[model samples]
Target: MNILELRKKAVQLRKRTWELIYNHKNGHTGSDLSCTDILVALYYNVLNQTPETVGTLEADTYIQSKGHAVEIWYEVLADKGYIDRDDLEKGYSTFNSPYIGHPTTDVKGMEFHTGSLGHGLGLGVGVALAAKMNSLKKHTYVLMGDGEQAEGSIWEAAMAASNYNLDNLTAIIDHNDLQITGTTDSVMRSNPISNKYEAFGWNVIEVDGNDLAALIHVLTSENNTGKPRLIVANTVKGKGITVAENRADWHHKVPSQEEFEEGIRELDAQMEALNHE
Candidate 1:
């Protein structure tokens, strides 16, 4: 898809996501909105895996380490036909529903169960390492939260990725800078993450994560450096809706009826504008 197409899909997903969260009365609202673009770009453009292609050892792998934002992921997967759209919209976050707040192996598109914050990169490293040993062409992409950087285990995984020279591994940090409690700056000082990754032998690249074109370029770039690549995606905590953008309180909070309406209007305007563009 072109940039405009990707942008429209993102807005559409955001509209559905707002409905899901507002109606269900659950979700990491800010976190889900913040990473929607990146997820959209991947599912629509970068990833070679599809509903039929996923699960094979040789297929491209995507792991949502920042799994609290699973609502957006579920929407993208549904849109891509990896999972049933109606099943997700109807059963999400309800009793006996498999569409929980985090990614689970029970889900059609999920490769690993995630939500424990700092374990995703390690799992990706393991997959990439195995792929390398088998001389497979698969690439493993892990999307992690900036707040998750505080976990010591993530660093250990970083070291392992480097040590193995896993060029097929790509780790993306959704650096929205806010957590459930407050700003990541105040909760834990994990800034200068790029330089830290560089020291760990990762080819660090920083970009406006909310920018679809930029994300596509960086995500699709070749890694000639023979090291794992890391993208520091600078993004707002709540990206699409003006009322929630950068608001720490919105991290895991449900929107009031008034706020939900306002957000839907904003996303609708965005979709219309993209059509004109």
Candidate 2:
């Protein structure tokens, strides 16, 4: 898809996720919105894996470390035909639903069961290293949260990734600056994040996480160059909705009826603007 089409698709996904979360009465709203464009760019443009190629050695791997934001991931998977729309929209968050608040292997296209912070990067390192040892020319991607950077395990994984020269691994951080309780700076201060990764022997690049064109260019154009890469995707929490933007409470707060209606209106306007463009 072109930049405009990807932008439009982002709005659609945002709208769909908002509806699902509101109806189901649960979700990490801010976390989900903050990472929507990142997921869209990966699933719709960068990823080589499909529903058919999932779990194969020849395909790309995507693990969402910030699993609380799985609502957006679920919507993206459905859009890509990896999961049935009916099952996701209707069965999500219900009794015994595989569609819980986090990523689970039972869901098709999910490479790992993730939710525990700081683990995704380590898992990604292992996958990328295995692929290297197997001599497979495939890539692995891990999407993590800024708050998750506080976990000491992330640094441990960073050191290992560098030691093994897992250049095929690309880790993206949703640098939205907020977690469930409040601002990450107030919590653990993961900024200078790029510098940390660079010192750990990983190549680091920072970009506006919400911009599809920028994301596509960086993700596709960058050469691996014999080191793992980290993209600090600086993003706004509760992106695309005025009321929810940057509010930490929205990290898991279900929207009120009024907030839901307003959110739909904003997303619809975004789509309409894209049509004119």
Candidate 3:
């Protein structure tokens, strides 16, 4: 899909996720919204994997380290034919549903069970190393939250990735600047993300996380520097919904009925404007 088409698809993805969250009465709303575009760009444009190709040696691997935001991933996977829409919207967060709050291997497109926050990059490095050892050309991408960066494990994995010169590994930090409690900086400052990654001997790029074109260009680029790449996606928390935008309470908060309706209306208006464009 072209960039414009991808943008429209992203808007639709967010709309669907919001509805699912509302119906299910649980979700990490702000985190989900913040990473929706990143997920869309990866699933629809960058990753060389499909529902059928997933788990195969030839398929690229994706791990959502910040697993609380699995709603966005679930919506993208369903749209890409990984899971059924009915099952996702209905069975999500229910008793014994694989569609839990975090990424689970039972889900068709999910590569790993991640929700432990700081462990995703380590897993990604392991996968990338394994692929390299097996002579497989698969790339491993790990999506992490900025708040998760505080964990020492992330830096350990970063050091290992650079030590191995795993150029095929890319880590995307959803720099939404907000976490469950409050602003990431106020909670635990993790600023100068790009420089920190670069200091770890990784190639670093920063871009607006909501911009489809920029994400596509950097993520799909082949300019590997014999080192792992880190894309710090600067994003707004609760991105598309006005009421929740940059609000920390929306991190794991379920929206009120009125908030849900207003969110849908706002997303619909955005979609309409995109269609006209």
Question: What TM-score would each prediction reach against the true structure?
Answer: 0.99, 0.99, 0.98
Off by over 4 Å in 3: none
Backbone collisions counted per model? 0, 0, 0
- Preferred candidate (lDDT higher): 2 or 3: 2
Off by over 4 Å in 2: none
Error of 2 at 186 (Å): 0.8
Q: Between the candidate structures 1 and 3, which one is better when assessed by lDDT? A: 1
Q: How far does residue 256 in candidate 2 sit from its true spot (Å)?
A: 0.5
lDDT per prediction? 0.93, 0.93, 0.92
For model 2, name the residue pairs that clash: none
lDDT of 2 by residue, 78-122 (tens): 999999999999999999999999999999999899998889999
lDDT (Cα, tens digit) per residue for candidate 1, span 78-134: 998988989998999899889999999999999999999899999999999999999
lDDT per residue as tens, model 3, 1-277? 9998998998999999898889999899999999999999999888989888898888999989999999989999899999998899889999999999988899999888899889999999999999999999999999999999999999999999999999989999999998888888899998977889999999998999989999999998995489999999999999999998989999988888999999999999999999999
